[model samples]
Target: MNSSYDSLVDLFLKSLRAEKNASQNTVSAYANDLNQFFIFLQEHYRKKADGIELEVLSHYDIRSFLAYLHRAGYNKSSVARKLAALRKFYRFLNKEKLIANNPLFFINSPKKDKKLPRYLEEKQIEQLLALPDCSTPLGLRDRAMLETFYASGIRVSELVGLDLPQINLDLGYMVVYGKGAKERVVPLGSFAIEALQNYLRRGRPVLLATQNNDALFLNYKGVRISVRGVRLTVEKYVRRLADSLKISPHSLRHTFATHLMERGADLRVVQELLGHVSMATTQVYTHVTTSKMKEVYDKTHPRA
Candidate 1:
């Protein structure tokens, strides 16, 4: 890209980090989306990106870009995400007076299909948790991780980001830094607390060895475990329990929320627990529970 485009993109990304507290993954996604848009502009205009000013771009250009994405085989969700990224970028530009107005301000996003989040059955969760052998260091750690996931409906990123000070075993709660660097306290269940205590006292030390890392979870090399490491550990145990299960650590999060909703937990409370900024995002679990109730009614109701 040319210097002008690079400068604007960098400035916008910096704002996302400094102002919005966007994560690295989020910033990178915005960057990728903006770069793709600029490339499309270059190809459409048959000139370098330096010649295409943000001021001259209209809603038609934005619509054309969406059309191009669709033609290039982008799905509705993918197109929607790209459009969202562009919308944000353009909004930032307008705020900074780099553009007179946001071209995407009036554009509509494609509707995304409503797909229910996958969750484990209570029996399956119990079986998966029991699969980890507590006697072994890795097993104890795995048990704690699994317990924590089911106890707190945090994202996988928040789970892997946990540090020693974040967890309070005595109080049965943990501090979580969720999206946008928002902080929330999530309660840990008795089972999770016990598992965590065991890991901290026995498993973690054995894994830590001589390492001075302050991470709550560590890899075999005695360092902080990566997100990929946690996924692999979960996958290993999941495969043993059921080869066709096809669930990730995230499924445990869904299970946590679903179980709570089934037990009459309030929607607003669940939203706070899940650290969802919008109640709309947490509303999906309602559909999950409602569907389950319908299934149970169909089976148990004599009149039906």
Candidate 2:
């Protein structure tokens, strides 16, 4: 609302990109969350007996904002994310000496409901992989892309950011830059390697035409594919394969990790493959695998 608010957010976002190496999506989410919070503050203080300045903002004001979000029908996860944005913003202000005290010090994010990540069975994955036609150039690219997701369990952003130099088809692995721009080597499966090889030999060159782009995956225009493009490709086949299935490109990633864990892969190894900074994030797949086991036991166990 105010120029000062805008400037502070801009500075904070710059630090996130420059210092923390945050992704564009992360920066945009934080910006949107902060803007929403500021808008609520403007309306809130407008009705108050005394307008509260940013420097003098307290935990009570933060709680009031959370209450407003709840009343406005924001889900717990969404409210928690907004709260995180506020906390980070206030911390930045305090560090910059723009504010004397951080009002969000006592604030806590809302507890989220523990929903297990969705993953596909091997049969479903096989069915999904078969849906992409490899006869055409775009089909070849989509097949390679889908194979890569399941093979490496990489995030969509990382996959789309791939360059010609990052992949070593001969070695059966590729280097990917994950969150915070961290670099790691991910191994590719035989099926993925073959698909990628076919795309490179037949599909990619046709799409490349006269263009000189070094991007691993290119659109018909010969430019690197966008994250949205990859998602749409994944969605098209997923919808064709099964209308009831709620799968995204990320679901392929989930399938990758879940399948690995189901087969007794170590938690740390799965974490390393997924490029997770924390093991806790990778541990969720363990639950998914366990749930799957329980379901199988219920169906096949004679004692039950």
Candidate 3:
């Protein structure tokens, strides 16, 4: 790797971790995204990765890199994300006085298509959650995790980051540390609370064979369950019911938000519960529940 590029990449990621308090996942994604651009720069200029000097690159050079991505058959969304990563890296260079010119000034990101998030019907969610056998230790943990996913509407990262100290079963709330280390207290339903209590009493202790681990969910190794493990656990049941719809832990989070909006939960409130940094992020659910919103309007509004 080039001396300048390596230092700048390290600094950028350090800033992401220290200044923004970005999660490990975010750091890893940004590293991957930026490294991909580095590889593109190497290949485009017919130079080794360490030979490409980003500061000397032109606007056309950057645009060509983007063009290369398009030619490589990257999807619009993926390309946009890569572009975003590139833009941020350039901005970091600008801020650090490392570059003479900002090549991204002339570039614009492609417009993103509006795509509604996929969510399961209430019955589908019920069936999916019910598929876990709660009688066994692993089954109890899986049940609790699913219940919490639906009840809290948290990101998968937040789910796996949970510890015993963060949850308040008696108070029926949990402190979720979200993106940028922002904290929000989310309420839990009776079902989730009961599942958690049952798991804590019956399932967790049995799985708690290894000492000194504080994670709320554990695997057979008595280690904290990983995000992949959580996905696989969700997929096991999703596959049984996976006829037409796509379902994952993310789908469960989407289902939580959609169901809340369908039941007339306030948009801002849902935003807070979900720990979304912006109301605009939560507004997509309004679009998803357009039919339900229309039903409410038709039933209540005199004009309808």
Candidate 4:
């Protein structure tokens, strides 16, 4: 009677934090979503969040919550994410023997809107890459980092997390640690290799400043470059040359994937390169390619 629901929720969240290695941000977001769901339950059952019983909650009850979110004008993607959080928490409850039946086991998740990622056109990418003045150490590092981004289509985290042993410039590939610390070998094109070589020889050493940082990319202080540092570096060049294009470092990542797919790269190959756990995630770039092809066809055809 003393808020058993709250106790179970705490146990589940603790599992996410300790066992699953979820970040505080992730745990907090999941916690907030569950809090919203419980508030809706409270409105229905007239009980505190911890007083709601497992036997009383049903799939229809969860569906009603989804409907409530929709009525409140929550976007489809947000609704879907909330449902995902529910699924995880309920699964945790079931695993802990707190629930006799998983109420949400068969519940269908809310459909999410299809969103195509934004990317730079090839010409625009070339312009952005050229904006970095390679004469200076910081500029050379930025240039190499950007070159590696486009060449591999790597997540900015993976790009910045790179270390000396992870890269094999001579072999034209590098091992990228991705989500959940999963490892994948991504090919680095010659342009990326050359840029990396230059930075290693000229830029990184100049910035090293007698510090023993093993991080492949370094800041002005000769320390590991933070994610913000990479984003700002890209933004500076992008704001200068491609002023009209409101893009982030991920735009270069998207451009890398879209360009490769447009040039007839295998979808699975692109998936591996991008470190996508699902081919469906990689398939979004195909949509971009198809759209581009249609645009080209519409513009160039003379038979109309």
Candidate 5:
């Protein structure tokens, strides 16, 4: 391509890599989005736009780009992500004084509906955990996995990425690496600790074919378990429970947070345990718990 375009791409990528410390997946996503933006500009403007000079693009251009995406049959979520990438890029440019204003600041993003997360009741959680028969080696591993998910309230991504060294069995705590590579230590409940101990002693070694010693949880094939595998295993156990309580692995996370709040755990502490970047995100669990309490009060009170 043109030297100016090449230089801008390189500069932006270097900023993301060196300054932002973006993960490989994040960098790849940004590159893909920006590349699409460049192609759209080339086709619409009829002149090949290049470099940081293109960073001076107007709200009109951005609107047209978004319109083009919609017309090209892109889903709302994909369109939203593309707009987000553009906004981030423009903010970076404005921060560096490469632009007088952010065009994205003027353009309105499409509204996205908030979908409430599904969560299990305390009884359902108990039933699901008990569903795993700890008599067999695989059963012990599955039991430990489910217990850890509920006890720690960790994301499936964080859970699957856990290493053996991160667990402090004696102390009943585990360190989780979350988004942006931020690390937080979360306490494991007694049940999770017991399950993990059983897995470590009787189950994990049976799964290991070689000295694959890094992962905290492993599949039957002795490899580090994947996020999908974890989800599937959780699904399998949830299905064993009544069909009324259909749940995913993330549901366990929600249940963990909500149950903690219902039990009067501090909001900030729950935020820290969940590794939420903002307490506001963690505060939603309080609302969920409150709604349940209100339902109970309405049902029991007879002051008609």
Candidate 6:
């Protein structure tokens, strides 16, 4: 009987490469998920990972792995993705006749509640953007950062990773490399263009004194700004605007998407601008607008 789990893992990886044609990122994700699962199985079943029989894995083992993930502070999304990988692996094993049955076939995934993302109101967004004083070089840079965030709706990672050559200030657009290193060009608003022009003229030169070259936004230390630094800068300005509205850099992204949808923008256009792989992901903003409309209707209707 083939009892070596390591051999099965090797075969599975080979199959993924040859038959599944999985990308490098997909292969890496599967490897990590399986390694974590193997560790959990070893601890729970009191057997070494390489020595454990494939058939020894039961539905209880799967449940235990999920429980361990939850206890270790993983969020629902992470847990769900891990479980999905396990399910796919087990299904493959069963199909190959290596396992008698798939344990995860009967197991249900954890119910993940879809929480509507928090976003800023239009007036609050304006207030936050205006909060940055543009007289000083740092202030000009901050203003440009704030405007670019709202105008492009790019992720903080994408924003921090921006390069000078990727931006076309005269054309009012910038190219962003998003998740999976996929590149897309997004248009900037007039406000962002103006702020960026001011920063390039006044702020970037001072920042460039110590460091030379192609990064778009820089920190006080003359290096490219980090995601954490951008988040802190955003939080600082948000705090200055209003005490009640809790805001983060991502709130600006949500506001940009939501406001565009509310203003009759094409969902496909918004999806492309947000660099969403699926239009389904961008459609959530419409639900947010619909919920707001219901709130206003309930408040004004005179029915008993």
Best by TM-score: 4
Local accuracy of candidate 6 as per-residue lDDT tens digits, 18-75: 9989998998898789888887776776656453355766677788888899999999
lDDT of 3: 0.87
Give the Cα error of residue 90 in candidate 3, in Å.
9.0
User: Tens-digit lDDT track for model 4 on 59-147?
Assistant: 88878888899899999889989999988988887777777667787788766778889888889888888888899999899889999
Off by over 4 Å in 6: 1-101, 300-304
Would you list the clashing residue pairs of candidate 5?
Answer: none
Q: How many clashing pairs in candidate 6?
A: 0
**When superposed on Cα atoms, how far off is each prediction in RMSD?**
5.9, 5.8, 7.1, 4.2, 6.2, 6.5
Candidate 2: RMSD to truth: 5.8
- Compare the candidates by lDDT and give the number of the best one: 1
Predicted candidate 5 versus true structure: per-residue lDDT over 14-58, tens digit per residue: 899998899999988988898888888777886466645475677
Kindly list the per-residue Cα lDDT of model 3 for residues 61-146, writing each as its tens digit: 87888888889898889988888877887787788786756778888898787788888989989998888888999999999999
Worst 10 residues of 3 by lDDT: 46-55
User: Each candidate's lDDT (Cα)?
Assistant: 0.90, 0.88, 0.87, 0.86, 0.85, 0.86
Question: Per-prediction TM-score, please?
Answer: 0.70, 0.73, 0.68, 0.76, 0.68, 0.70
Q: Which residue window of length 10 is worst by lDDT in model 4?
A: 47-56
Better of 2 and 6 by TM-score: 2
Worst 10 residues of 6 by lDDT: 45-54
- For model 6, state the Cα shift of residue 288 in Å: 0.5
List candidate 5 segments past 4 Å from native: 1-105, 244-246
Clash number by candidate, in order: 0, 0, 0, 0, 0, 0
Which candidate, 2 or 3, has the higher lDDT? Answer: 2
